[model samples]
Target: MDRTYFVYMMASCRNGTLYVGMTNDLLRRAYEHREGLAPGFTAKYGLKLLVWFEQYETAHAAISAEKRIKRWRRRWKLELIEKLNPRWEDLYPGLVPGPA
Candidate 1:
């Protein structure tokens, strides 16, 4: 079976700093930090909020996009998100498998 991949955006809080990464397991990865199971920049910087994520068919493609986005200026990244999510809301509230 093919594994699913995700290109995710995480924020410090509502509109704090943003971080982009690619993961094969979006839920588990997000949960890891939410539950403090993972450590590093995200956990250290308190950037556990899942603001946005996009599914990709292949990990390779997801990773490629992630690296490209990471190279983008902060202004560019914010503009990209604003175009899709004007409010900069926490997208996980709706995408996560739970109540709102």
Candidate 2:
């Protein structure tokens, strides 16, 4: 099966604490963060809202994007999120398998 990878960012709130990560399963990983199943920075900082994401064909590319985003200044990161999600709305609902 073909695999897809994602470099995503989660935030506690608009312009709040942010967390950048990469995952092959964006929905599952985002769910884990929402439910506090994955321990560490995200859970500790309440960064459970899926704010931004980019898909990649290769894991290497996803990882590289995640790393690059993580190193970006807070202003840059915020701008990135705003560009795609101006309201900073939680994107987790769209990823879930259910009625929209």
Candidate 3:
């Protein structure tokens, strides 16, 4: 089976603190953040809302994208998020698997 990777951004709120990361399982990672289970920066800053993400076929590409975004200016990061998620909604719900 082909594996998928993702570069994602999370925030404390609209126009608030931002966090960038990469993961193979977006849903699990988002859940960890939402539940305050992830350690370090995100948990400390309460950056639980999934504001933006992009999928990649390779982990290398996803990691590179995440590293690049992490170095971006705050303005550029905000602009990127707004471009895709204007309202800055928590995208966790949509990522969750539906009940069987």
Candidate 4:
């Protein structure tokens, strides 16, 4: 299988908190967030819905993008998501399949 890397943004819900992160395995990392598996800021802030994501060929690139996004203000982040995901929907459910 080909290795994939992702710089992703997760939101608590509509017009809610946002979290930025990077991972080599997008699916696994997304699942971790959704399941609240890791005890960290995301869990504490209830940021679990995958609102936006960008794929990269290398983990370094993904990490860089993640850092850039993290530095952005909340309003800027919201604008970014709104540009692609206007509804701010939980994109994770659609990515995996079955019931959301």
Give the number of the best model, judged by lDDT: 2
| Candidate 4 residue lDDT tens string, 1-100 | 6678998898889889888888887788899998899679889988889999989988788888889888888899888899999998888877786765
The stretch of ten residues in a row with the least summed lDDT in candidate 4 is: 91-100
lDDT of 1 by residue, 33-65 (tens): 666677887888887777777789988899899
Task: Assess candidate 1 and give its TM-score to the true structure.
Answer: 0.84
**Tens digits of per-residue lDDT for model 2 on 1-100?**
7899999999999999999999999999999999999999999999899999999999899888889988999999999999999999999998878865
Q: Which parts of model 4 have CA positions greater than 4 angstroms off?
A: 97-100
Would you list the C-alpha lDDT of every candidate in the order shown? Answer: 0.80, 0.94, 0.93, 0.86
RMSD of each: 2.2, 1.3, 0.9, 2.4
- Taking all chains together, the TM-score of candidate 2 against the true structure is 0.95
Collision count of model 4: 0
Where is the poorest 10-residue window by lDDT in model 3?
A: 88-97
Tell me the spans in candidate 3 whose CA falls farther than 4 Å from its real position.
none
Off by over 4 Å in 2: none
How far residue 1's Cα lies from its native spot in candidate 3, in Å, is 3.0
Better of 1 and 3 by TM-score: 3
